[model samples]
Target: MQQVRAVVAREKDAPVTVETITVPDPGPGEALVRVQACGVCHTDLHYRQGGINDDFPFLLGHEAAGVVEAVGDGVEGLAPGDFVVLNWRAVCGQCRACLRGQPWYCFATHNAAQPMTLADGTPLSPALGIGAFAEKTLVHAGQCTKVDPDASPAAVGLLGCGVMAGIGAALNTGRVGRGMNVAVIGCGGVGSAAVAGSRLAGASRVIAVDVDDRKLEWAKGLGATHTVNGAQTDAVEAIRELTGGFGADVVIEAVGRPETYRQAFYARDLAGTVVLVGVPTPDMSFPDIPLLDVFGRGGSLKSSWYGDCLPSRDFPLLVDLYRQGRLDLDAFVSERIALDDVEAAFDRMHRGDVLRSVVIL
Candidate 1:
């Protein structure tokens, strides 16, 4: 076992604290990662709030990049000293989804079998099976996707979650194509990424909608062809007007709320796609929308999980694109902070002051 400094949330609605946790050596199919950087994501904040589960003493942080420090028996293709981005989906090849050749929906993802423990020997539940808000973490070998070492850790790490989700929503789930008009609601990290993805996918007009003027400006910087201040206008109407009064070819909802979802549902052209990448609370439910309207829409309404990303195929490719300056991964990282500042970072997130505050180890 090795002692590593980690940020731990002992209970629901409590502050995270830095503590020394015991991380065991890799077991079969596992690897130990010496974390270089981890992004403070909203999911981590949700985990801290017990919105995810009742896993107390939760070791938070998931979007991360690091160097492999050790490899377990039976682990192949990965070795110590490899630069890697941590992924939550450690696909089990024999699962039904994998058998169907859609490993991105792998139902049997692997995680560390051995638990990291607090100093008192109490087992700690790692968030998203990663628990990367630490100097080091243990994960299934399949969770480590090798990427370009030259890429900035703070920037690349964001791709592990939010960025991937938004990009995937546009390119994969939405099937946005060249010359298509795309409108994205919400200009936060995930939404801005969708705008960038739409541009990369060759969308002729990428419309970005957000209530915050600052985020709207950021969206323009990320390649939004047009911007809508939703707080000041009807989002659906704005999107339609931007797309020649016919609505967009693709509408992506990155703000997980019934209101925004309804806006997306109505803000697309006939046979156009609507991709929901934003997560919603369990208590939230959709209001009555005529089933006739659903049939009348004549298009797909899809939900994107982790941007439907097949990490093995996507991570390295994205890293190369970032290297080539085709992808602006660095723009997603709004700030960098020490692990001790995770709480403050969370506060900033709540205030909508930053896109992402990464923790550099």
Candidate 2:
């Protein structure tokens, strides 16, 4: 057993505390990873706010990169000292989705069979089954994806979550291809990554739409060919004008709001794809639209669950690209901070002051 300093939310709406938690050795089909860097994400804040569920004394932090410290019995292809990125999805082969060859939508995912606990022996619910804010974490063997050791942990760690979601929203769900005109609504981390993905996929024109000009600038740096300031002009109209007045070939709704969803619906040309990668709150209602339009619009309307990504297929490739400087993953790291600064990072995130504040251990 190892005692690691971990951040946990003891109750709803309370400040997170860094407590000494006991992490057990890797059990069968599990692995222990020494976390090298972790990015502070909004999801962690959501968990602390009780937005995810009622599970209290929850261990937070998910987007992470680390080195494999040990592997348990029955593990394959991973060994001690291997550099890796941690993902939340650990697909169960017997799940219906996995049996049908779509493991990304696996009905069941597994975690560490043994629980990590607080000092008093109270079991702690690790956030997203990945409590990596600590010095070390225990996870299912499948959660560790081996990547190039040369890549920056702060940059590649992001591929574990938001970056992958945005990228997959374009490449997989939207099926964006060469010469296509794509528009991404919302210019936060996910939407900006969508813009980068569109460019990487060889889109003829990538338009970024957001209420904030600062975010739009960041989008341009990430390869957005055009940016639409939604606060100043009609997003749908501007996208149409940018796409020769016919609307874009693909419209991605990265802002999970009724208003933005509606804009995405109207902003696409007839038969264009609409991919919703943004997450909506439970209380948010789906945008009401004419029933006939859903049938008449004539294109796919899909929701991306974790960008519909299969970790085994995407993680290493993206890491190699980042190493080659073809994909500017470094652009996403707004700041490098210590673990204790996570609360301040969340504050900065809420205030739109940074893209990501990484905790370098």
Give the poorly placed runs of model 1, Cα more than 4 Å off: none
TM-score (all chains, Cα) for each model: 0.99, 0.99
lDDT of every predicted structure (CA atoms): 0.93, 0.93
User: What is every candidate's alpha-carbon RMSD to the true fold?
Assistant: 0.7, 0.8
Q: After superposition, how far is residue 49 of candidate 1 from its true place, in Å?
A: 0.8
Model 1 TM-score on a 0 to 1 scale: 0.99
Q: Over the stretch 104-197, how does candidate 2's per-residue lDDT look in tens digits?
A: 9987988999999999999999989999889999999999999999899999999888999999999989999999999999989999999999
| Per-residue lDDT of candidate 1, residues 1-361 (tens digit) | 8999999999999999999999999999999999999998899999999999997989999999999999999999999999999999888999999999999999999999999999999999999999999999999999999999988999998888989889888988898899999999998999999999999999999999999999999899999999999989998998888888999999999999998999999999999888999899999998467999999988998999999989999899888989999999999889989989999999999889998999999
Which parts of model 2 are misplaced by more than 4 Å?
none
